[model samples]
Target: MTFEAELRKGNFQVAECTNCKKTVWPPSDFCNQCFKEIHWRKCANEGKIIEFSKQNNYYFCLVEFENTIKVIGKISSGIPNKDQHVRIKRCGMTDDNYFFEFSLI
Candidate 1:
């Protein structure tokens, strides 16, 4: 399925930066780099895993969303980089929710 299709099924909103022209997830009002009032735009849900690590009780991946915005999230049950495309990563304190994250493949 495409990113737009996922948006239709889900209720999450897309985010971007007005000053720096960057896209962000989890909807931030301030740009991480410029610290300006950010804008909101529909994301492509396409990105790359720039960095990843396992720290005790958590698996973290620093995903560069849309080749512009980088965000970190927990990894799901799968071999790392097996899928280059956008895949779901488990989130939340109890590890129930799954959000999009890309791999190098």
Candidate 2:
């Protein structure tokens, strides 16, 4: 399934190439390594905040997971700092697209 579909189901996934065994984040239709068809795989849902910024009402964070999966999400509860560990609280899609919101650990 697509990333949006995974988020809609309250789960997270990444694309992996069956041929090359390469993992792809930000889910893509094809693999970059071997140009093979990609399949979605469940993610660990654990990451560390690489960078973050506070906006008007939200804290936007760039969370880096294992295998170099970097997802940009908003902090669910409160502010988070760089290198802070976080976990997925919930994920959903708005009218626009799938959004990942996390909580600091």
Candidate 3:
């Protein structure tokens, strides 16, 4: 299965560069830094919202995880503040489509 499938199944994971020892976000086939092979690994769900914006009733956030990986997740049903520490409330397929949602903590 693809990374999106795994993550949608509530599997918190990311790619790590074996050579550089750096974590990669938006999982790729090769390392962004060294152009080497990358492997999947588990990642902490905790992150800080560095920036955010609301559109169409959803707060979109640029969450920085482990200070290296930044991902966009939607926040629903709560007032989310900037720089707020958040966690993955849950991940799954919405209407059989991949979806990500977070909860402010």
Predicted model with the maximum lDDT: 2
Clashing pairs in 1: none
**lDDT tens digits by residue: candidate 3, 1-105:** 456767777887788888997776667867888988888887788999999999988898888889887777898568788889989877666676656688888
- Residue 62 of model 2 has an lDDT of 88
Model 2 pairs in collision: none
Better model by TM-score, 2 or 3? 2
Of 1 and 2, the candidate ahead on lDDT is 2
When sorted by lDDT, best at the front, the candidate numbers are 2, 3, 1
- Candidate 1, 1-105: lDDT as tens digits: 222343445523456678777665455667677778875555545556666777785557776656655556666554445224444332222233435433333
On TM-score, the candidate that comes out on top is 2
List the candidates ranked by TM-score, beginning with the highest: 2, 3, 1
Off by over 4 Å in 3: 93-98
Model 3, poorest ten-residue lDDT window? Answer: 91-100
- Model 2: weakest 10-residue lDDT segment is 1-10
Clash count list over all predictions: 0, 0, 0
